[model samples]
Target chain A: MPVAIGLEGSANKLGVGIILHPPHQTADPPSPHDSAHSDDEAFSTRTQKHTSPPVQILANLRHTYNSPPGTGFLPKDTAAHHRRWVVRLVKQAMKQAKVQLEDIDCICYTKGPGMGAPLGSVAIAARTLSQLWEKPLVGVNHCVGHIEMGRAITGADNPVVLYVSGGNTQVIAYSAQRYRIFGEALDIAVGNCLDRFARVLNIPNDPAPGYNIEQLAKKGKVLLELPYAVKGMDVSFSGILARVEEMARKLETSQTSGGGPWKDDESGQPITKEDLCFTLQETVYAMLVEITERAMAHVGASQVLVVGGVGCNERLQQMMGMMAAERGGSVFATDERFCIDNGIMIAHAGLIAWRMGFRTPLEESTFTQRFRTDEVLINWRD
Target chain B: MAQPPPQQPLRTLPPPFNTSAESFELIAQGAESLLYRTTFLSPAQPAALKVRPQKTWRHPTLDKRLTRQRVLAEARVLVKLSGEGIVAGGGGRKVKDPKKKNDGGGDNGGVGALRGLVPAVLALDWERGWLVTEWIDGVTVKLGIYQRDLAADEGVLRGLLGRIGRVVGLLHLAGVVHGDLTTSNMMLRPTRTPGTNADAMARAEEERGEVEVEGGLEGDIVLIDFGLATQSVSDEDRAVDLYVLERAFGSTHPKEEGQFDEVLKAYGESMGKPGKVVLRRLEDVRMRGRKKSMLG
Candidate 1:
């Protein structure tokens, strides 16, 4: 059995995970019904009968940097933060997993769909480690890990995946061939939009005002009717962003223009932060769920998996759950352990590649802040 | 104890961004492709390396003329810019302590000279298509050198200019000209601490005559990114260099208004005969730039 260690540092979080698996363990893998070479032996053999057993929880640890949302997107800090934590996190995870460093099989790290800095750190660490230890290296897709973990937990044969996070928000569907992007946010991710809107509301992310907004939304009524734009499976939030800024201005209590309206300018605004928060929650999550619902209708699939940091949002989960119930489909939302970014997802995706004999040579260790997902042809046979 | 034995090997190394890169390992991705910090694998430390994927080189029918040669040319021009302090004072204060002076500087950091530019042709093996070179350390004046106090004093700046003049003179002497002379090419580094009177020291001294290259302690400057650099005898080529520098100074260090005139003064004091030719055309280029800025 070849051992695989995982490192996920696409964004601010530096997550490390290790998995020891019997080589080529999967007996039943997703069929290559989506690709053109459906009848090929190599393609067929790639699909296996045995899945890596559920008991294969290796070592996993995630460390996050306190970067201000929207602006914490610095490449240098991402690299520096990863450098600070890679060795320590790996050692800690190894200790927790009760495994020695020498016994590791290969190193796997996120390849792309991230800022340049953090991705570079993980790549550098893995390149050095693989060379020193004489182990193979594997680069994993940041998005695939989320979907893989979704399938591992939910057992969704085929489903609509809503990849909603800080940098990406897309309606995704995996055919027998490949993951097809059905619709995507035109500008920023849903969570990013919400975070920016929250900033306008003067919400601090010390404890992550995302949770605060959820709590506050529970106590207030939706007085402001905001724009709810969903086109087919795609959605637009720029109008929502502009309208909210206007509402913040009109309400006068918006506390914009650096300081709030004084006694002379105070008009006793109609909407409070609480009301705005409630309406925001109602609007954004509804847009996401509606888009996912439309994607489901287009794909004719019954299951949905919500991944990324926003997957942990209870409001999003509840709304998704309600939509799933109405459509007679199931929605799989990751727990906090899996949410908020972690290395286990990368490791999970890595385990699949390791089983398929995908390995990096000693001479190759680099990070692409923007590597393509579909470029590396998946050897779909498990 | 701080210095390792000359023979000790490095513990870690830079990685290749792509799997196919052969010579230089991809250290990080740049605006275009993966930046590879190469591994010399010898007793000496390897300079920086970057890998631009071969796939991106595939141009449609429209852009056949723009080639890898263009990339090398751009780097060469940048190297020249660094030498002139148009990028920043070479090996001076800005690079030494970059966290000083943030009162009201309107500059983007990392607008400095090439930290190192020896142009070592390790091997003509760019199979992976990368332009590997030394990574300069000093941040740019755009970063607000005052924010980090990275500005070198007048003595250091003079040392920087005298050295820079000789470099620009060498380029003209070598028959090559830098098309772009923006200060972003400048490398501002900290000077070694002086004995005294450092407080009253300014960056640019009042130049009235020929450069006094005393003590033979000339500063270091490296030009980079020679995309537009071309061998030239025409007055237009050299004038463009001064023009670019003037624009860079006006934009980057806005507080130092008319500072471009001071740089030309220093440049004139340094270049001698050809310097006068460049100076005569500098005014023409300035008027053209002003007209373009207004029209745009």
Candidate 2:
């Protein structure tokens, strides 16, 4: 077995994980190896049939920096928080995995598409570990990490990926050697929208604001009308966020008046915070599912894989499953351990590349905040 | 994952379609609508019928709202383009007035009016998601480009490309953006003589495959498929629209991709002042790429 450790601090979360890829069983014949330039041909050949070996997760750990209620985490503070906990998490992960210095093959870290400061902080930690352990370094695209980990956990091959997190929302699929983006949020991300709305309602920052909003939404009864801005396969959430924030203000002001509940003008019924949460979830999830379906129809793909923090929401999973079922397909997702930002995905994806003889030199191990999912050449996948 | 079973045949056609179902021949099945080739009022006149089927997955209210909104939006753009002094009339004369044809027969009006750049909307039913328009008799620009030898017919190809640019320019000038712009969405309507017999017109369309390579390119570029179109006057939106076309041309016609500059040049000339600004913005858009960076 080949083992690798990954470090991730793209946003406010700092995670460390160790993973192992067991050698293929000798009973099954090995697949043919081809040159990277023939990736399209390789993909077509594998599309007929391909199976991946099981991956063992030795240890996975994360520490999130949550801001106070009514506020959001700043890049500077989040970066400082990551720098403080990354070392401890890495040490604990190694101890938990019962691994030695010689057992580790390479050190992997998120290279970007996130806050510059946080990404840089994690890169520095990864660089130090690479030198201390005298191992090669592999720079991983954060979004790719989420996707690769999701696939490994769910066993979905060549599924369309809907990656939604606080920083990004994109519909991606493998074509040639890249995970081409088919659609995406034109403005604010879905998770960011939910998190900011939670701020307006002063939701607790304990666990996660998105998770809290999901719980509250389950108790909601009325489905208030919200702007549904889906243009082609792309969507915009800024308008929805602004409108919901205004509604939250009205609810607060009306509640202050003799402690009465805010009532709708037309129906004259009380509207609770739960109603707001419900409306936001229903509207946004619908948009997400619609775009995902469009992409699926475009590529003629039957399987869909949901990744990132928003993928952890049960409501989103259920809605996605329903949409997939209607298409006579299925949806693949993972629990928080793999769906949310975690180092295991980075380690897993990077290990795959490393096995294919890919490595990031010490000098080129720098991180970028503007890396695109399609920019990375996926040498590991056919 | 398994492939979805073949869709079941529709149980019954909606209101206006119920009586005309037998006459309609299914042509294409799109994501949002089913396109059929049929006749309008009489058997001699051919028409294109677009039926936006209701999606079972969506809420009835949302589905109805989207269907109605899109049907109206497409109709509005087509009507505006086909109206007097617009693209159909060449920006000066009334389409309904025969005597005023000479005045409209100039740089902008002459080619557009005579060419029939857009199919005239004959009828529409927004509530039922049905829009019928005069059927265009021509081959798709994709086929035209593929059939024609670029090296031997470079001049004609450039002219056709330029006209396409002009048509798209007129569309953007009218504050409308064809969200999806591809070679496949454009038709090369064969030119017709004033006294040409109906047989000759049909023959020209039928002989497109055999004559295209030898006869050189001939026809007006008519844009179609407005399912994703939007009414927008912003330079950013206009630039994105052109960018989409530019990408389509690159991928679909890589052999003649270098000739695309002619398209942009003609597009800029048709756009004038606003077009110039949009062309400038296109540079920035191209540099950053169409979609925004994935980072927060």
DockQ winner: 2
Per-residue accuracy of model 2 over B115-172 as CA lDDT, tens digit each: 2567777788877888998888778787788788646756678777877787788788
lDDT per residue for candidate 1 within B59-158, as digits (tens), equals 2111122334445444434334234343343322322213223311233222222223323333222233445555444433333223433343545344
Which of the CAPRI classes, incorrect, acceptable, medium or high, describes model 2? Answer: acceptable
DockQ of 1: 0.01
lDDT of 2 by residue, A214-241 (tens): 9999998777778887665667899999
Q: Candidate 1, residue A340: CA error in Å?
A: 2.5
Once model 2 is optimally superposed onto the true structure by TM-score, how far is the C-alpha of residue B29 displaced, in angstroms? 4.1
Candidate 1 chain A least-lDDT 10 residues: A34-43
lDDT score for residue A304 of model 1: 90
Error of 2 at B294 (Å): 4.0
Residue range with the least summed lDDT across 10 consecutive positions in model 1 chain B: B1-10
